[model samples]
Target: MKYFIYAVITIVGIAVIAGFFIVGSPGLQRLRRLDETRISDLQSIQSEVIFYWQSKEKLPAKLEDLTDQVRGYKAPSDPETNLSYEYEIKGEKTFALCANFSLSLGPEGNNAAIPIPARGYSKPGFAEVNWNWEHTEGRSCFERTIDADYFPLIKDQKTP
Candidate 1:
């Protein structure tokens, strides 16, 4: 009788643990994955914009302007809709990148990515997570400003 009770307890424990993850819902998980992709794309666009600003001392007029064959860099589009991300130049050194997200990410950008996956799960650390990427569901825009001191214009230094 004791062995039977032990088996029941172990099964119940496993079920409870499994239920916790099941509640997360497969569809919801997919949405989260899409949002993750959106964030990643935005980060890439942001880097490209900053680099352009540093080189030209101004924001690109449009996303296409950031594409560089020499650097082998191309602007990424929305993963779910396969549409171009919205880009708007707000000022000489400021621009906004917009995309639609299916779900809201946690404050720390999906802190639940700790446990190892079947292959190996990895969560972004503090330095990896951009503080500006936080957004609610639906359309969100990340506006960036280029600092002149930090991203100075590239000028050819002429030797006298």
Candidate 2:
């Protein structure tokens, strides 16, 4: 009887540990899914921008242009947060895309890079998570390289 009791206790303890791990596993997995979705959404926006620029001469001043005016498309927000993504207009040819400031869950504010797939005019690029205006070398404060012919979609209007 004593051996039976000890075995039962061991089983309960093991079950508790297993339960914790099992419950915790999904949280980690959810975070990874969120990150990937955010990255993929950003990449999709970049590709859409490339497509828009190809059909037109400049990038839309805002994201809604895709949903409202552009044909066969609409901008997608993050699935987890349901918030519109943010885009920084750097110049006539380059821009930066990110989740809204509040959507970033990273402690150090470094979001992952959207992989630049070798298709269409969308080249892979990275973004910093802050608004620091410093001109650090190799650490673009708010600048990006726009190399493709479709890059001009992001250009801002110049006043005469």
Candidate 3:
């Protein structure tokens, strides 16, 4: 039954190839999901800080300063690690936010995601303050600055 043996080997080979993809996809998907969550968490924190600056005319001393019972907003933490995101005030108008990312922002060895635009703040002189969200595997941080002259424009818009 040489033909039967060959058929069995062919089926087994096909099954093995299929199995690899089926088993491997979930792990990759989970990593991508975690990366998306990390991006979302950073965006949330950025918005809160911008809102705080607009309302108070100064940067919050720490991330906790954005927590307010009246607004029902609480600082977000890492989705997979359950650790608090990193924050540091570099200047009166500058701050940095950091997170541990599980995957590269794009294909390997390519910094395709550099200079991600800071959504919602579009004033002419204030354009430079938009934070960059580019990152690689492991820990990455984004720097931001607030131009106080545009604070009035921020006030006119509702908190996102």
Question: TM-score, each model?
Answer: 0.71, 0.54, 0.70
Per-model CA lDDT versus the true structure: 0.73, 0.56, 0.77
**Deviation in angstroms for 119 in model 1?**
24
- Score candidate 1 by TM-score against the native: 0.71
TM accuracy, model 2: 0.54
Q: Residue by residue across 1-160, what tens digits does model 2's lDDT show?
A: 9999999999999998898676545565565466556555766777677666655777778998767453667888867679787777778777777553222333333232222232233333633222222221121223344555424333453336
- For model 3, the superposed segments whose C-alpha errors exceed 4 Å read 1-24, 107-118, 122-131, 153-160
Candidate 1 vs candidate 2: the lDDT winner is: 1
Q: Which residue ranges in model 2 land beyond 4 Å of their true spot?
A: 1-24, 68-71, 100-144, 149-160
For residues 1-160, could you state the per-residue lDDT of candidate 3 as single tens digits? 9999999999999998898566545676687678777887898998899888888878888888999999899999998989899999999889999998877774452334333344565656555444456678899888887666665545566665
As for TM-score, the candidate ahead, 1 or 3, is 1
| Candidate 1 colliding pairs, count | 1
Candidate 3 structure, TM-score to reference: 0.70
Model 3 score (lDDT): 0.77
RMSD (CA, Å), candidate 3 to true, equals: 5.2
**Candidate 2's error at 22, in angstroms?**
10
Root-mean-square deviation of each candidate, in angstroms? 7.3, 9.5, 5.2
Residue 137 lDDT (model 2) = 17
